[model samples]
Target: MVERLRGDWPALEHVLVIGEPSWDEFITTPWEDVRDPAVLPALRPDPNDVTLLIFTSGTTGEPKGVMHTHNTMVAANDPLPERLGTTPDSVFHMASTLAHLTGFLYGARLNVQNGATCVLQDVWDPVEFVDLVERHGITCTSAATPFLHDILRVPDLAERDLSSLTRFCCMGAPIPSAVVRQARERLPGLAVLGGWGQTEEGLVTLGIPGDPEDKIVETDGHPWPNMEVRVVDREGEVVPPRTEGALQVRGPFLFVGYAERLELTRELMVPADDGRGDWFDTGDLAHLDEDGYLRITGRTKDVIIRGGENVPVAYVENVLYEHPAVEAVAVVAVPDPRLQERACACVVLKPGASGFEFAEMQAHLAEKGVAKQYWPERLEVLDELPRTPSGKIQKFQLRAQVVDGPAG
Candidate 1:
């Protein structure tokens, strides 16, 4: 970059670099306070002009740097709080990696946008998280279904003074209605919300404020203003409500393109004759309700989405982790015309724990309020969990075990 923009990119005003001893280090600026952790950019470009480059997780392949202009960031950040009823005083938290859009763009931006104190923790410790919330009066947090479950394990969480908490929202997994209800009852101060977003569109969908009791847990809220979402076929025409299709979103929050992968970018954003703008077809399948609420079903490529239901393989695997008798598990979908596809879960038991029953897991899921239909039909015990260097679960390796094989 220094070589490519040798003349165009002049000296920077202030640079705050986050130097992680192990993880990849990142450099960011544009703040008024110029420090190591926080940098102040020397040049003051117009908010609409400054370009922000954020990295994408790239579970599909290598990590991609996504480009976003300041105008794009502001457009995505501005209206979020009111939709979630967050305030300047609200201390936002998220366990998800900040490098990801949800944590980076939304969580970090909230601090700057509201002039609120931002808490940065390197790890997700439930005990420490609750302590920080109590210590700092954190009001809003974005997380996944598993994080909430772990927090609920804190004994008598309901009795704790979580009064400062205003918003408890999650993504990347389905939050069971029971979990949401329990959370609301446990943390009466919290307005429990289930949200859905992709790295591509910058986490734009949210559940409505004061949504119906069932709606909050059952569906990811609705689209934000100025975001045009279309459930389209290969031809790209809009589909009606309740019909699952490739979730195509074109809006201000859209990432410019995959960081350095130009070929992939071309395939993703190949525009029509009119030359309107980029339309990112988030591989995830989702549908909009009559009232415009968006609910994510499943990934378009990984597993076949039966009807409109999203059989979240990851969500189910996370649930298995909550079982005391279980050690590790991976849920994968197998092709089945009758059900579109049926799920099979592979598990590894604790050293001493044995006689792990498939029926028992079904009962466990039932008790936990996981939809019965979403339960795995077959179960296989594995020796260990396959993971990447980053410790992320490798679903592809798990998927290979079930291919051309009998269930379980």
Candidate 2:
């Protein structure tokens, strides 16, 4: 492996190998020797100096490298301990990859900042998660909505001792109201909170422990302290409450820019009138309630247009999730020669659940008071939804399946 690495990059001057001693002959520095206190460098960096570059999920398109500095990271983590009500005795359980922003912030940085114990899991498994919680007395954790669904599916979940888990912060996707309801009923002590954010702008909003049930399930809570969020029309004018439009955010913790992509970064942002590049166009369609809570309706590009009418994809998907048989769901825009596009509901059923059909889905929607036009015209059942590593459904893949004339 060392020879291969040297062959790929001949300019490499140093190699330090840790863990296994079998590779000691191939490297110059030993891991044990590096632990000497005298060998460490005394280095101090400015707050604005770049410290990290995180890549986006690329669910929509190509992944972009987002640049972050020491000051930006500090601003991102400063409000978390107070907001989460963490104490030194608190134990944090993390199952997401550290490469993602969610894992880096809540899973790693927040715990260190609070002087709390953080248990890291290299992979996500619901049974293992429950075991870790009981063993470590875990107080809080963050994951995508699908993790909550999988936990609810664990056959022995009800028998497990999960009393130590107090908070489950669901992020990266729009959480279904049904999933929240099931979690509350199954784990009576856990606060299942919803949140919304992106790599470009850390955590924009998150539900607190005591938020109302409807707010926790229906909307993605209020913005973090010192951050500002707004819903604006194409003309950059602020929209009225409950009016869906493009979501924009400005905060101290926003990323510096895309790595070596200045023009692309400029295209994604709206410059402030004061000449500071502060306002970031989030590319999400959302609405703010009268009380300032944000509800993410759908992405700007993810919306399904049928017969010149926009279909609220997330809204319809949330309603469908209330059905007892649905384990997971995704609504995608299918190509239609006449309507330009049509909505198709792709679903994953719970164990032993069967006999789901298009008419049944339409009837369910009707019973829920959903508009007939918004009901999905087709239904496809799959064993699982295509998901990004961060747990967001890849709607683009579903759209391709629909365009390809269904799977055999």
Candidate 3:
């Protein structure tokens, strides 16, 4: 990866390798040496000083580095220990990449801050996850929605003793209602909570234990402490509750700025009446309930317009997840000469399941009372959906495949 980027980022000076020997041309240092008491400095920096730069996942476009300050990072995770019910004896299991904000905050930082034991996994395997939970007595963990689906698909899930696993905070995508319902039926001790956030804003909202089942599955919980969320139309005016619009957020945890992209950062910010340039446009379509809970409808670019009608991709995907055969699913737009674009439900079936035809899918939609125009016109079965490391389905890849023609 370094070699591939060397040409474009020629100014890159040094590379430090952790857990592995550095290449001959670069600096080599032991991880333990950096932590030596003699070499450590007692330094106190300003809370506003930049502490980290986390890059966006770039599922929609190029990744940009988001800047976070010391104060912001602390504000981002301060509520986690109490919110997640993380006691000193609680064990945190992490399977997602730490490069992402969710993994960095909940997996690493929160564990250290809360004085909880952490179990790390280099790669995700459902069986291994169950084993680790059983062995370590893991009490809580967070991951993308797909991880939950994969865990549920483990053939021996019923045979495993996963009572130690109590809380699963799901992010990256909307939690399919069916997945939540099935998880409750299968693991009565577990609470599968939904959440919403991005690298630009750390943990904007999270579902808590004891929320109604409908709220846990349908909404992405209420906003984090001191964070304000608003739904607005194209004109930047606030919309009525329960109405879909662009989601905007402003809080102490919001990124300081995009690293070295001041102009681009300014464009994404909205001026607040309090003379603070705070509100950051999230580029997500969502609605706030009367009680201020959020339901992410879709991304601004992920929406599919079929014959001038908008198809709710997330809603459709959630409904399709209820089908017994679907192990995983993604609804993407397929270019259509007439309708501009049409909905295609790309599905991954369970090991021994079959008979998922386009007509059968249409019948299922009809049974669920989905509008005829919103029903997917085509069905594509694949071994798996293309996903980012954080387990977010890369819809752009599926759209590209559809435009380029079917793949074998």
Candidate 4:
């Protein structure tokens, strides 16, 4: 890869490879050696200069490079200190990759901003996580819902001493009610907070530390300082509380634009009717309650149309997650001749589960009082759902797999 890049760019110079052997004019050095004062870059970047180009998770489509200026990146971490309740004495831990915004902002930037210690995990392991918490006295960590679910299932979790950990800020996906209940029962000392955000905009809304169970489980939480969120209908008019609509965000923490995709970036910008500023359309369906808490419903493109009726994908998936036999569930659309698309439930069963029949799922949904039309027409059992490194489900890939078959 280095040779290819060097050949493509004639002006390429000063190659440095960390933890690799030197060969063919390439310089290799230990990772720790890069921190030496002599090897650091002397140039200081301006606040307006683009310093980071992070890519979206690509759950919806092809990943786009989101450009963030130094000022924007710094602003992204500003609200986190107060939101996560981090302090100089706190010990942070990060399992998510730093390439993503969650890890970049919380794992590295938050620790630097708060002057706290941070432990980096090379890979995610629930058992190792328990040990890390006890070993490092980790106080605060931010990761996706899947990580919290895995930690609850650790065989010796009951015996582990994890009281040192105070906060578990869940992002990238919604937290189910079942998981929240389980966490409350098992780890009473720890707070499990749900949050919502994207690669373009850093963490936006996060549940407060002492929120009630309903706020922690049902809604994604309140917006952070300097960040504003609004749910607007198709006509761009703000919707009333409890009505689902397109989610829009406006904040200083937002990225400058998509790299080399200026036209695409402009399309997402909606001029604020109240004249505060331009709001970035998040492409997510959400609703705000009377108390101003945000509840994410589903992606605009993720809605399933069955017999000309819309199926609430997130609602149905959350209902299925309540089943004792189910560990993870995702509701996706499958093409049908009569109805444009039919709802299909893709599920990963917990250990010791034989099967989750379609009849059983229908019965579970009926017991939960879900409309028959909203229930998934089919149940497809899988070993595991396809996910990004940050643990967001790849529904597009799951839909394709359900329609055709898994790639060889």
The candidate that achieves the highest lDDT relative to the unseen native structure = 4
> Best-fitting candidate, measured by TM-score?
4
* Residue pairs of candidate 4 with colliding backbone atoms: none
Query: What would the per-residue lDDT of candidate 4 be over residues 1-408, giving only the tens digit for each residue?
Result: 878778778987666665555443344445455577665555456789999999999998799999999898888888777777778999999999999888898887888877889999989999999999999999988999999999999998999999999899999998999999999899999999999999999988999988888899899999989899999999989999999999999989888899999999999998767877789999999999998999999999899889888898899999999999999999998888999998889999999998898899989999999998898887899999999999999998988888897422
RMSD values for the candidates in order, in angstroms, are 6.9, 3.4, 4.1, 4.1
**For model 3, how does the per-residue alpha-carbon lDDT over 1-408 read when each residue is reduced to its tens digit?**
997888999789877676556564244545456667654554557789998899998788778999999899889988776677778888998899999888888777887887778898889998899889889898888899888988887888898999999999998888889889989999899999898999998899998789987789889998888899999999999999999999999989899899989999999999888965479999999999998999999999999999898899888998998898888898888888999988888999988896588888888899999888899888888888888899988888878876687633
Badly placed stretches (over 4 Å) of model 4 are: 7-12, 19-43, 273-275, 406-408
Local accuracy by lDDT, each model? 0.71, 0.88, 0.87, 0.90
| Sliding window of 10 residues with minimal summed lDDT for model 1 | 21-30
TM-score: the better of candidates 1 and 2: 2
How would the candidate models be sorted by TM-score, starting from the highest? 4, 2, 3, 1
lDDT of 1 at 199: 63
Q: Alpha carbon lDDT of residue 178, candidate 4?
A: 96
- lDDT per residue for candidate 1 within 226-327, as digits (tens), equals 887778766777789988778887878877776668888788874656566767778877788888888776666555355556676646765787787775
| Candidate 3 segments whose C-alpha is farther than 4 A from its true place | 1-43
Candidate 2 regions exceeding 4 Å error are 1-17, 20-43, 274-277
Could you give candidate 2's per-residue lDDT for residues 337-388 as a string of tens digits?
9999888899998888975888889899999999999998888988888888
Backbone collision count in every prediction?
5, 0, 0, 0
lDDT score of residue 102 within candidate 1: 70
